[model samples]
Target: MGNHVETLRWNGSAIEMIDQRILPHRIEYIACDSAQSVAKAIRDMVVRGAPAIGVAAAYGVALEAILRKNEASNVFSTSLEEGFKALAASRPTAVNLFWALDRMRKLWETHQAKNQPELADIFLGTAHEILEEDIRINRAMGEYGASLLPDGSRVLTHCNAGALATAGHGTALGVFRSAVEAGKRISVFADETRPFLQGARLTAWEMVQENIPVTLITDNMSGHLMSRGEIDAVVVGTDRVAANGDVANKIGTYMVAVLAKRHNIPFYVACPLSTIDLSLATGEEIPIEERPVDEIKGFRDCHWAPEGVSIRNPAFDVTPAELVTALITEKGIVDNTTLTAGELADFVKKNQ
Candidate 1:
């Protein structure tokens, strides 16, 4: 299946990214001239989705190198370190950000003998390659995941895991796209994904663009819909997956997983190998991002909460390994029921 959207592109000079904050209403692109600008864009939600953020961070590193090409070795090294730190700090939950940055850092370190200008070319080229590779990875994962869905399946998803979330294609939504392409007439139920509405804003927009059958519902309505036997399966994208198969995704993902478990519906998590953090033994060790309380209190200047109300907004929640039916990756699916931490370690090693 072809990607219906291009979330990020390089123009030989700067990184151009879709501004996700105004999606489904206004389509806008933002150009990042410096590493700081790219970092700000990620933190500001101008660019998001784990894979997209990773690609953006890689470009941010490249932009830093391009801007600091004239600096002396010591000065360039300092600036490069700062650039990595800034981009990595933009979002803490996505392991892809750290993975991409680490790749760039290692590549830069390997060519330390070269001049700064020479290293600049290497950095930008590698970043471009990373973006391309991500698109390919998403497609491969899509194919593997698509097989899991039968004809006329109604998949429930949280947040926006379509093209807007990755370099192209998507993780969870990619499976749906591939399944549709394989002649399986499937529909999607997207949760509004509270405080951000990534599902309502981005997911719905992407599906409508491709003429995919989709239904928009509030986050709280997922269980009701599932109980009515309206949902056949749950497929979601994750920020990080632990060695034990635990998943950390959008805030309300855990609740959806629990509901799926109760209804005996299969809950699947779609992600690339880059999203797997084998270093973390379990989800308890995964860092969850705490967003501002104001986000829950209002919706882009529209406030509904009463005065003096206290709100807590966590960007993600960990779904225990036991809750996941299986994990869909580029390598294939790993059934959580029989999968073990040691087996996952081996899978990561062989895939890597």
Candidate 2:
């Protein structure tokens, strides 16, 4: 009910985001004014999640346009395009960000000739709609996702897929939360997603606040735990979902999916349809960002190495479609064996 750290919040003038690095311990706000800064914030994980970044990028571009008082249409348009490119390049993989940007661009171009002063308002309004729609989709996803789980059965999840991760209650975690509140016996085992630790710090924190039972385990320890017959289902969020159902999530998520497949466990990808990229026909086309080497070598803030130890830190990894059991969207938990943009558009229509 209170202000959540993981979601995006606007306080009239500026956009505020939670500094996730010090999360579960510190509550710091990163105030963003320009599109470049906002893009960097997302690239650095100051504000994350596909939908969140998309909405933020839309507003960031609007903010950039607003700051440019020079009404020279060419100059102002160029500035806006630059801002969009900045935000677009930040994540490279999350289709939601690009989709939201394109939506804003289309609306702006459509109204640019007739309405000038209202452009900012239109941008803000479109962003609000996007955020609201995401909440609805996630809520439906929760309900649809709940149906996937047997009543009074425990569920296992990886990463932070809850309220903090998006505009409201998260995708995969959305279903998990609804199921628990409905008096279904559920326990969540969160993989301590390493390098970034979205699981240990963000997901675990949310679970604790909600008073949901959670067992935190190291990312590598997931297979061991499941092998010991400790897991029932594996639900995780996606940075992007390929047409073939291959999921790009946090670096270790592929491993979780692999283990789930090995254990014959049900592995589900819970996400908004916006995260789906129909253009990229295959997962191999998705670019995986290899983060700073320091991420894999040492923890944030506190240094562990002597002087210079090279570290290879890849921000995300891809899980092939072969391992995914199902794709959970607002419309329903459907298998994307033959995926299409129509499925996404239909999903939106169904939610409405």
Which numbered prediction scores highest in TM-score against the true structure?
1
On residues 69-115, what C-alpha lDDT tens digit does candidate 2 reach at each position? 35777777788888988988898767788888888889977887644
- The pairs that clash in candidate 2 are 162-170, 293-311
Q: Worst lDDT window (10 residues) for model 2? A: 1-10
Residue 291, candidate 1: alpha-carbon lDDT: 84
- Top of the candidates by lDDT: 1
Q: Once all C-alphas are superposed, what RMSD does model 2 give against the true structure?
A: 2.5
Off by over 4 Å in 2: 1-6, 305-310, 336-352
What TM-score would every model get versus the actual structure? Answer: 0.98, 0.92
Native-to-model Cα distance after best TM-score fit, residue 132 in candidate 2, in Å: 1.4
